[model samples]
Target: MFTNTDSLLPRDDVVKFFEDAKTLLELRQDNNVEFWQNMDATALEIWLREDHPDKADTLNSRICLSALRELLSRHLAKMRCAAEWVHRIFEVSISELKSHPDYFILFSELCDDHPELLRDAYIHYGLAQAVQTLMARWYLQPKAEPLAGAKRALPHTFVKASDNEALARLLSRRWTSGDRFYADRDLLRPVVGDACTERKVLIFTRLKESENDSLSLAFDRARTVIEQGPRTSRLTETFADGLLRLPLTSSAGYLEHVRSRVAVLYLFDDRALFVEYPWNRSGTGHQRLAHAYSIGDKALPVQGTDYPVEQYDEVDTLFGWQQVYVPELPEWAAKALAGPSVHVPTSVRANS
Candidate 1:
């Protein structure tokens, strides 16, 4: 929830939001994609209007309901992670749309109108909404029954919800570019593997040998773009254009791999190379990039009127190399270097 007083949704009202989603998903067949697109949560706006006059009003609401809690479970099963949570941080904005076509097309369109759409804070919001849109598709799939789907109430945690305080430290870290020093060089070895070194960094993508090349190419292409950029006029813009033009498909798998590699290059490597599309909009993360290239202010690159991307209701996020560098890590890291023992969880996910 945000620090804004008027914006907070009480514990129970947040739960009601889920019940309403369940009820609405239960109510329709969704035979026409166009129809839902046109209506796009206006129906939901009315359904929950008394509670939240506008659907956006529901932003920052706590999703501590049993069903949502179940979705935040540490264990994943049947596209649901309903287990006891170690910690849950859900900052949702525009959680679901009335429509089901929330692929890259929808994202592009939204970015067209809302410049804030590309910020790091809202990145997961869009991702979560995409998941909801995908969930709608699953419920509306051929031979599937919305009636039963609503009853199942499979709460899907969106974005990077986590139980580990260690991750909160990193994800919450201020986004930046240019060369900066980290606190403990060894602490990042897990996330950066051997890459966190003065030697030319190599990406250890924690993927099976069979599936690695496909993702590795993504890194190679990104590197090619970064290497070719003109530092004077188009370094950030060239990289930005390349990011927009990259052959990287916006599939669930591709995004996972892209982000993993993005973190590696940005953190372990010296080049700003680039970060997410819109940059961090809050003017805090990578402000120089935003100031220099308007990275966070530009509309997303879209093809034609609509962009097609794989729609999914849930994203399986793991603690990657970036997870170890919490906001305070630099300070803590420096202290740990000079001092005695301090407990810091190393990456089990990174390749040994």
Candidate 2:
């Protein structure tokens, strides 16, 4: 239940223009340059304080004056301080401000004072719309329709909305890469066959003496994956490629113990394996030494694609490690592997 716009007093002409916004949707819309250029002192202050709190505050709390009393006491608690005042001036923590209308008023004042920060302030508020939607759904409140897609809402207009668009692009790209970052049901189910069965996958915690104990604890939470399909592969960091590279013999012992007992020792909290080419080595030797490379005899070395590691911790904690034995050679590699089971005989010296 919010007004689109609030009428300003005669002196505050800047606010009068905005008061034209009669609904929350109108208020939520981006403000443009023409709107600012037409502002009188009153309207200017309102925009400055909300849009640029620091600059407005510097010129005597003209913009945020109305809401300052309620927020000043809560300021420290509301928004944490940055190292430099200038940094705070540019970046408004819209989430903290949006919850309290008084804070929003102050934000409006800040925006009025420092027009340059307008783009940033709008973007902050725009992103907060997503968060607000979540909150509304959780609280069973009606969702607010965002004033999206008007010509005035251009990139040059409001900093906050501009920031929102930037974030949208960033997230879109990250989502595209998400599959490589974590374990997916589709991936494991096809290779290991349903993750639920006991023999197919076992989750073992590194912080334990007994694999049996780890499995017991995991079973309580892992009923779906285990019963329906792919088994959870959990192992100590020691069993993982990068961790194994750490110079510690004790690590190898721990890894061997886990590997010998379980079909796949889950590399707990470890990122997926990838390839690493040695700068000095050329041809097969260099290509063979990737993070995802196979060790010992596969009867023959197999080629595979390397997956990029993003925020490994996020994926690892959400979905435990997946252990798949040497991947079925990809189509291209399989065709090549079929031709040769033995190494080419070559007796040339190093200098030759």
Candidate 3:
């Protein structure tokens, strides 16, 4: 489902524009750039709004502005040039740039040579394409049937590691620092093991007390899985203590407690996860999780509807959070953790 056209500008056009822009900059004559002049950030914003009213409020425009800001900042940092002079060279008209889709790409390349502008872009534009290609080769094909026999349950042992060093020792391998921002195939080699071609990995994390620490770890794990390959793993996060099987008792003699928490769902086919966690504040985790779930399946869908129920799928058996079930975990309780806008099937609600 991902295409190269999803970028604000095509890669080829971006490179070409960078070359052209560089050539233009070499021409220092006053007649070479009569309209080119420096402007502040506010002036730049005003010019964009005036020139391209239709695109002024769009996401692409925001990305363009972000790219420009970075470019200006970088120039100022290196050259110590006046902001106005930097603007003159960079601030061509926003309306005119729209006609040439390569403008933003060119600007971005000139600034940071990276394929993605924002973190979301890295996920959606860069990672999404990689995932889509992998999914087409794996999940879309007919799966082979298991051999005819009563299969014994695979023996599994749970090992608790106090820290990364302990985890590395348990795995009988040394751990290396990994780039958490981008997923690459080699980073996941150790986690997937020798039968990496056939086996799948799933990373799940649920945080109860430390939201910031938990989410950060979740993202790191997700990126590692992603770099390994699409369909190799899926990552999900929830702020509910119940999801992690942590005991929560009410002091007011109430059976259920209603507290806002956040959850994140990442599909292998898409690059970006659904929810944006607040790394700074407290108590908004549930609200952030609910907002992510509400965005529909264009990103992550409601479990049991778009895809089969996985081990980590959290469901509310009742109309609300009064009762919850995680079928894979085989856990049920009256006071279950549930997101505010989590999707509930009509049949499940009716049964409740």
TM per candidate: 0.18, 0.17, 0.16
The C-alpha stretches of model 1 lying farther than 4 A from their native spots are 1-165, 172-185, 190-218, 222-241, 244-352
RMSD of each: 22.6, 26.2, 23.0
After superposition, candidate 2 runs with Cα above 4 Å error: 1-87, 90-107, 119-352
Best by lDDT: 1
> Per-prediction count of colliding residue pairs?
10, 55, 8
Best by TM-score: 1
> What's the candidate order when arranged by decreasing TM-score?
1, 2, 3
Clashing pairs in 1: 70-82, 73-81, 73-83, 105-307, 131-313, 169-326, 170-326, 175-285, 191-321, 278-296
lDDT of 3 at 330: 12
State in Å the error of residue 228, model 3.
36
Regions of candidate 3 where Cα sits further than 4 Å from its true position: 1-140, 144-352
Report the number of backbone clashes for model 1.
Answer: 10
Which stretch of 10 consecutive residues in model 2 shows the poorest summed lDDT?
A: 220-229
lDDT against the true structure, per candidate, is: 0.29, 0.26, 0.26
* Candidate 1 per-residue C-alpha lDDT over 1-352 given as tens digits, one digit per residue, 9 for 90 to 100: 2335754544555556656645543343232222223232433333344334465544433444333434222111211210000001111333342233442334455445444434532523234354334444543234533453222211111112143232234444443432223233345432333333221122221222223322222222221111111222111211221322321211112222111123322321111111222221111222222232331222332222122322121211121222121222346433333433333333223111
Worst 10 residues of 1 by lDDT: 81-90
